[model samples]
Target: MTMGTAGLETQPSATTYELGDLVAQAWSGKVHVPHFQRDFRWTTKDVLRLFDSIVKGYPIGNLLLWVRRTPERSFTLGSLRIDAPAYEEAFWVVDGQQRITSLANALHPEGHLHDPFAVYYDLAERKFISQPKTREPQHVALPILFDLKRLLAWFRTEGEAVLHLFDEADRVATALRQYKVPAYLVRQDDLDVLTDIFDRMNNYGKRLNRAEIFSALYAGPEDGAEERLNLSRIADRLASRTGFGTIDTDTILASILARRGPDPARDIRNEFTSAGRRTAPEFENEDQDTAYAEGEEALVRAISFLQNEAGVPHLSLLAYRALLVVLTRFFAHFPAPEANTLRLLRRLYWRVAVSGPAVFKGSFTQVSRVLCARIRKGDEHGSVRGLMDTMAEAPRSLPTVERFRTNEAAAKIILSAWWSLRPRSLMTGEPYDAQDLSTLLGDQKTAATAAHVIFPRGLTAQQQLYAGNRIFLPTATDPVSEIPVMLMRQPIDLDDRTWDAVLASHVMNREATGLLADGDREGFLHIRQELIAGQLSDFLDRMAEWDYEDTPSLETLDFDNLDELEGGDDHSL
Candidate 1:
């Protein structure tokens, strides 16, 4: 393949080497990974697949290396922490980091490497399997078996029963040492060109994304005389603090750019030069130190508003990344608004979320610019008005019961908003505390305990069930079987005391519960939809005070005749 030199193009030289020799080169400071490369991302299963391929005499892949004279820095190999000293010349792996890392970690695991690829060979099954920290019988750790003396000692003590397996172990060791991987050595000095080449080569596989490339361009030393800022690590830290899960690097970069002038939604790579600094006057004159600090503070405030006011308690429930950028810019412009203004802003936030695709129909950049301009002008009313105006054009209707089951964003927003009203559990009649509900929603395992269907799915056909059919029941309430049992009995079979208990325990209004008690499938759906739509309508109205005539309202479906309802055939109670 053609390689680019200092303003010149040339062909790279090729060579072949045994696997053991490559491992030795990495251990002895003759090879290293450059700072621009991504961190090791392969899992234990991937490592096992590599070893299995090697044992089967399959061609793994070729290694692309840049031969540099007078290396600029010292480095470590994989998770082994095998420090390689700076040398006059060293080969830096550019394209085959995953393979090289897997080899180094698997071969030299005895160095107590804190790697994820801990594996062993099961002698009984004759296969490679991922092993835990603790040892098990009939299993030989790959790292320990790399050494002949250790292998012989282990066999003498542990392999006496499976003496016939000695030949298999010897074969595995031979294959690892004798396997030759093709290599290409190129001499290139331009960092930008090297990054381009790396990107192009990886396109055939799991190529690097824009965020990863941006991170590589801006990443600083992990350990140095002066602590340098790493955007990736900073995003991770923010997510941990907010319990928002892992935030994408692009979102973090956009937030930082938003603090400065210009739309953060545009291509970020254009903002940075090859040297990794702002190129335009709008950004060049801005102090990066202040921008980063303000960006972080504004993001925290935005997340707080989302959790406390908007009912979006976690990051997974956040439907759009564009929303974060808009909120970040607003908070950056207006660090703290008055109490009434803050209340208006919170209302606007939930309205936008519930409005769905309408609020984000046009260019996100334009939306961010508009909102930020109003906030900067200290026009809180205008800011809220502008956002609502955009949302007004979209068809704003309460989602159907079917939509809640299928659409994740809608379900999260609706449930979170409803949960915020302190609705009582249908089973226990106890008011749900916001903190406990938020914790349960944030965790996957506990989320199921927060809500369930009043009529068990087994009793009704698919068409009869929808989001309105579900209720938020506290975990401490009566068993789930209790409700189904009462519903299964005839109306006369349930005494007045039991009926009162059922009505009080469920969050449904009296009209909706009466339909359920009478086994009127069509009436129950109509009443439940009206009840939920009414709740949503009231919630939106309470968010802010406005005089706009185009404010969207939830349409309550009414049916004069039960047979006229759609999907009535399969919805018999």
Candidate 2:
């Protein structure tokens, strides 16, 4: 350690030391970890990589330690090689899961480092063996052996050659003990500083998902029958499940409101949590449960609509807000106490399919108004029934309703419509076409010659990494840190020039790019003629056929005969 400009004293950390030293100190009763810490489960490969880097003199990461005044009861660590007390007072390992485990394995007296270390070598006889007598038994590296007596005993029997082996092991251990991986030791008791440091460091550089980190921190219980009564616990679980990454806090609040509807508890929770939540600065305890229930109900309704009626294959981060809107309307007018009404929901779904995502996203206000209108007439909202029936009867396009695009309002209507119908092919402009995955992927390369290349500007690595196969905003650029490795999931043969040319062609045909205006999601479709032609050619050349278990059928729905459609199905309302 060295002092900075402030004259704060620090030790001159050695770059070389004995692993036995750390082991001895630990066995002497220095507990370095807490009970909540995960156990040592590193496989041979994981350990080997650490050693390999050490051999090359690469600096392994530092051990983050929370120093405490007193140590607690101890246990043997890492294959029972070393014993140490568990840290009980007020300290924990905030980072460095890998390096510390490696160190623990290397120096413990009881540890066996001689199981097997995997390395490939050509054999005189044409076969691979882990060692002289061993067949490849999950070739593992023996633990780092550092006991002086053990080294002496083996050396006396095996000669100077054995000494050389011990010497090499000692040297590596020495380097590990002395090598300093950067450690951030925080003093005083402030969880905020620790969390902020952990979050900012990881976010700015390593970049774990916000939900992932939150899951680690606040994760408590599942939102099943047993856990639903606890508001905080239920919210945490819902946030972990439905909330995508950074938007978790908001999603948790939204989920609650979706279940219970408008209430001031949201405001109080918001005060304790953070901004962007549906909570206010204060909420009355008496009203907390009602608000929480409303939120939860909203989420359930939205999820149902998306899964059953909208035919959304999977939920996406972008679609969350839209779903929230849908749930608001569903809970407002229907007596969902029984499964019978859900059956009728199927008939209502057809209207969703015909409406298209664009219309639903845009017409949220009108949908809510309609829901309210129907609620006044009867618990069985006939307005929704009428709307679906009317939309189904036509050689004409789906009816477009205009309304405010308030996030919540929009989500409710969109979800309701989505629940009522099966999703059609966005490409073919028809009901989903029956095709095998092989056929889909194979022809996908070239089958749709007329298909447009969406996201022509190019997809960023972060977007591609998280978005899976979904099309994203074309203008998005991946951060410099995430590239090549992140973007390798798809074929990379198409060059930038080709992408631009394809996009140019699509622009020419569609007039002004036809990019999603509100979402800034323009040029997402790959629609240029030449590009489609090239894709088709590739499909024909490289596509392979795969055997699938069962093919799904598209249901023919008659919205007018609601009772017939809703009543006959086992799962129907």
Q: TM-score for each prediction?
A: 0.71, 0.40
Worst 10 residues of 1 by lDDT: 548-557
- Least accurate stretch of 10 residues (summed lDDT) in model 2? 543-552
For each predicted model, how many residue pairs clash, with residues at least 3 apart or on different chains?
Answer: 2, 65
Residues 250-329, candidate 1, lDDT per residue (tens digit)?
Answer: 77777777656445654444444434434342435444445566678888888877777666666655655667777776
Give candidate 1 misplaced runs (Cα > 4 Å).
1-13, 27-32, 66-79, 90-93, 110-115, 132-138, 186-190, 199-206, 220-226, 273-284, 287-291, 338-344, 358-385, 403-407, 422-573
True lDDT of residue 112, candidate 1: 26
lDDT of 2 by residue, 1-573 (tens): 122343213432323224445445544555254332333456656665665575557876655555445534445455443334554443345555445555554444344333223322111222222334553322222332234444455446533343434545455435545544555555534444444445445556754543334433332221232333334444444444433112233444434433333331222223334445544322234244455555555555555554543443223212334234434445544535234344444333433333444443445434433322332224344434543443343232322222212133232233223322322222221332212211232312121211112333355543332111121111212232332222222225545454333333222223223323323332322232233334323322221111111111223344558877667785754
